[model samples]
Target: MAPNKVDIRPGVSVLAVLRHLNYKPWFALAEFVDNAVQSYARHQEALRAHHGDEFKLVVNIDIDTAAPARISIRDNAAGIALEDFGRAFRPAAIPPDRSGLAEFGMGMKSAACWFAPQWSVRTSAFGEDVARTVRFEIENIVNDEIEELDIHEELEDVNHHYTEIILEDIFQVPVGRTVGKLKEHLTDIYRVFIREGTLELRFGGDALTPQEPPVLTAPYFREKDQPARLWRKDVSFDFGDGLSVHGFAALRETANTAKAGFSLFRRGRVIEGSGDEGYRPAAIFGSSNSFRYQRLFGELHLDGFEVSHTKDGFRWDENEQPFLELLREHLDSEELPLLKQAEGYRARPARAQLANTATQAVNNTARAMEDNLPSALPDIADAPPVDAPDEELPHAGTLARKEFNIRFRDKDWHISIELTEDPAESQWLVFSDVAASIERPRRLDIRVSMIHPFMVRFAQTDSEDVEALLRVAAALALAEVIARESGVRHAGTIRRNVNDIVRSALSEA
Candidate 1:
């Protein structure tokens, strides 16, 4: 056959504008992969018959980063047939079948032009003896306002079926950290197909494999006495508007704020939450710092959802909130109650984890406080006397209390600290008796209310921050005891002054 011409005439303007499209590197690369996947899917029966049942579709994407950078995506699949040549090359020529991933024919042209100054496609259809090649010089075509692209042809084996897209002088190249991220996004997007063993997608000669997020398995937080159960729960909901979701909701085996939350899928490919940007809506995941937001995870396939042209997001059509509400209801229940379980469950840290946390906290708090303690003790010891009331301590809402000993000023000092969450507790800092006993060490126990207004406003929610604050409180409590021991009559005055500073100044924040 003579060299053929594919008239992309009407799309002259559209082709020039495509280069400016806001395409993330992964999504742009996905356009080519989508076409390859659709081709394999469409001709699966014929392809298997020709190449034997053991055959599986494999797509290799290679990036040449050395000077004069180039990108090539080669797929062993049912390549473009001679009859579909015009529709395949022409811009905006929608395929007769919109059910497949290649519904938008513009994906190839736009992605190719967006990637480089020049790109080419070479393919030989499964049952044909002729292989075709089409080179697109984007800069020359746009500058000259060319309407047609010449398709080159060559004789090939009748059974050969493959497509190779080579892009040269590429402007958009994945480099450094972006190369790793690109592989991750691509793996996540095609996870379903990869899991089914139908697709072998590779980048830089290495096959991309899906890494399944491990689900939590343990007794419910409130039902600690019960036998451990797998936390993964199957969820299915219908919106009654042709749209439906079917998937499994579960908590991660371990909390990972970066990897938590839902992955939304459409037609077996993830549209949202591919890679680290898992879909974390407040309606389902709660506040970002909530346990659910850090441990919860799932794969929800939206069967009838419409995706953006870029195939990056779903077009919910104002039903996103409603969709989220339905999703939340499914994930929450009196039986398992995924949301509640996720929020309430606290994994008992391993011995190493507990020790590591304690060690880190001690190192951080003591380092900073050691600098100020010497100067503070002198002032506390010289304080004037004020009558301090001795009131009965209330241990009603005590959540937890820990007792430890520290050697300070040649005396073994026993420290007892209590944490309380009760709203009724009026005292933000409750001081207990510091028994000066000849039988044992000088023991001073103090209580701190966590739900106090001052704590809620001034205190940070992190454990490290809370630990630092408590260390400061403990240091002050110890200082007052030492001042009283040193015969400072107004040692109680220091407590009153410190309370006023915390309440009047710090709480205002």
Candidate 2:
């Protein structure tokens, strides 16, 4: 049979070809940064033999949105040869094998097209004073149709020894929105490359600087002769004394939250943090024993996989998912016993303790007295002290006394407070823990019931004085609870729940 021939389309612009890529908005920047890093590495290797540290390969991004209206990426690299600049412009083309860091020659065209309709690149290398340039505009060549981009002639520049990709007529993209988004998405995506000092990213004057690796590293428990100890905690329980399970949990606190979540890292770099495919569903929650108490962090070392040319990212192909799942299952086995122990601990009743119950009672009385006094009322002359007889005052109401006993280690205390009501008075109930050990002291504890207070306060059948008294008492009790609880520092979750409870009561009334 004769050799088969197929007609090929001509004049397909690079933009038309790049549009076919599954280029999401977030991935576009990664592609561009990858190309920049490749250029930097090329520059570094060429100069490494010369043994001069004059100018390390770097990528500088200038974000100027004024009338000049441009963004530029300049790199001092073994730029494209004067001839290759034009050839580089076409779609589906790969760079020569000698290009160290750049692979998949399509990244340049695809990444540039995603950002703007018009973009150009200039390059220079090896004692060449003038660099070659290639310019292509997607909109002009595509004629507003979604088609491949065609490359124009590669022009040589005069006196410029480096490459600068200038993006113009940027399709009216929002700079603020773009920069803020790029900051978050690209930060972790490029973390490892940045850390290795193999790449640099600058946005105007702001830069994402890299940090040194940790001084201490944690073991995955699978390693032999562990270099340093990875901290682990064991938890067990005696629930009804019959059943028990043993589990353990460990954490290297620093690395876990360094990226804002319990990232499952492999080979000292992040794999799970950047890609969802690398994480097992079970790993979504930390170790079962640590759901509420701690976050589980995993670090694995895999040095053999091929990382993408961007240098900031990589993949393990089909092996990643199963690998993560196995790790998660292992962590669960180690955490079950601890989770059981924690569950038992949380099931127990919570207790509060305080010294000087008598003083607290007296303070409560004094606070009540100050609160009840009206601003217009003049001070009574030589008023009877607290010890004075309970003589009948002009006020017509029944006083309600509520008393409670709170117990803690080694002491006993009593607390009583008076509530005045013009209608049905408040009731009191008292219970004593006579068997309470000296190791457990019962102190006076009082809590005003909010549900009943609001119910009676707003009753339609109540007299004006009765309603006013109930309202005052409810408001006073609420004020006291707020003052005491707010003064102490504690978890906001409980406080928020309490506030919702009070609000519900008030709404019902």
Candidate 3:
């Protein structure tokens, strides 16, 4: 048993692995930027000792789409040493410095191979007079014909301390449209780093700026003077082992478009969210499309948490469960009430819009009629006499007024409008339910015929204005019924004339 020695054989093809890397171009490019930033952070003391405190780290990325596409990323950080070249180019190598952003050493090699078939790196370590250069070709590695890494050493400027990666024969290049998207991705991922001025990243000739989270207002109770408002709360939670989360939650006054949810960030980079249902907690937001949850959004930073190899999401383990539970508790106890208050804030504008539209429609119709009318028409004072009032007028006791409850702006109101489902030959019918009334205060039954042509057409479209118009029409019908029951003279004639005018105006609109 002691004599048996088994040798391990590497059977994986480098090009085959590269083909299955599954990296978005933008995320792949971020690898190099991460490396550059980490390099600066790890060697900050050494860099300051060599140069002054004024020494700055700058990363520049240039992309060219002409002919065989090419991309180059250059950084003014402490460059790689001659001794570190072997580990630097090796795939799946663990980094020596793990405190910084670059933990796994696969970022550079994986990103380069994923971006292009041919890539090269040139670096001059700080205080070193010679620079080392290495070139990697996918075709050569795939064939397994290359045993030794070819590295060249050349004399460089005494003050030069930087690393530059150039990708040639690029399989695909980011162009006009994707360039902006790439910039946005990079900025969002490194917003904290950029905002703190720890790193300067330039894409093409433009410098990248941090994307600030939307400002959240504090939620306030709706009062007569200040009816609507938004509110924010600071949230912090600790899950032991130096792992903690801190951020702010905001309950907004209006519906959120895309900026609603907890944006989870780790190590100054956004891992998830700043979107709808980015982090789901049923107790806090209920479910997706819940009105209360839609108005809430925030950003939370995870101080110490394990991330996936791709760095796109967090590793949900036993330790993460407590953090999520704490977050849920905070939302339920503190944020839920603010969300309820925000409901009133959201409704005020919708109600105002409906009222304004109805008022404008009536005014427009009246103006059009006035402009078309002949100026020579006889006045109401000279009009023919009307018929005598009906002797058998309906009594007020014959009509019943029922109370209907409506919820608006987080408050309920009672009104005497009865709803019915019975089909009528006409579009709508408003009548007093005296026979059906047994209570002291009777309510008029305003029956809307769903089978009528007007109701059928409006129901199919489901427009907001259609609903508003229906409410207005029901109110007018109720007014007419009340006047008739009270025995108001000429009430029947007035109701007929108003109905005809409304019908004509609606046709014109």
> Which candidate's lDDT is highest?
1
| Model 2, span 1-509: residue lDDT tens | 11121111244554655655555444665555666566556556566555466545566767568764666777655666545543465555567763343466666777777667778876675556654555666766677543333233343443334667887765445377766665655555566666666556675656666432232233332332455443454433222323222333444233222232333332333433442222324434444233223234333434445555333445556655654454445544653322222211111011121112223433454355344533322332122211211112222232334454422222332334433333332331111112223574322232222123443333212223233433344344334433433443432334344445644544231
In what order do the candidates fall by lDDT, top score first? Answer: 1, 3, 2
Return the lDDT, model 1, position 222.
64
For model 3, residues 47-126, the per-residue Cα lDDT tens digits are: 98888887778899999888788999999999987667656776666787777678876788788888888899999998
User: What lDDT does candidate 2 reach at residue 296?
Assistant: 40
What is the per-residue lDDT of model 1 for residues 49-109, given as tens digits with 9 covering 90 to 100? 8778988999999999987999999999899998888889888899999898887778998
lDDT of each: 0.78, 0.44, 0.61
Q: Identify the superior model by lDDT, candidate 2 or candidate 3.
A: 3
Ranking of predictions according to TM-score: 1, 3, 2
For model 1, the superposed segments whose C-alpha errors exceed 4 Å read 1-3, 349-364, 370-378, 381-509
Report each candidate's C-alpha RMSD, comma-separated, in the order given: 8.2, 17.3, 14.9
lDDT of 1: 0.78
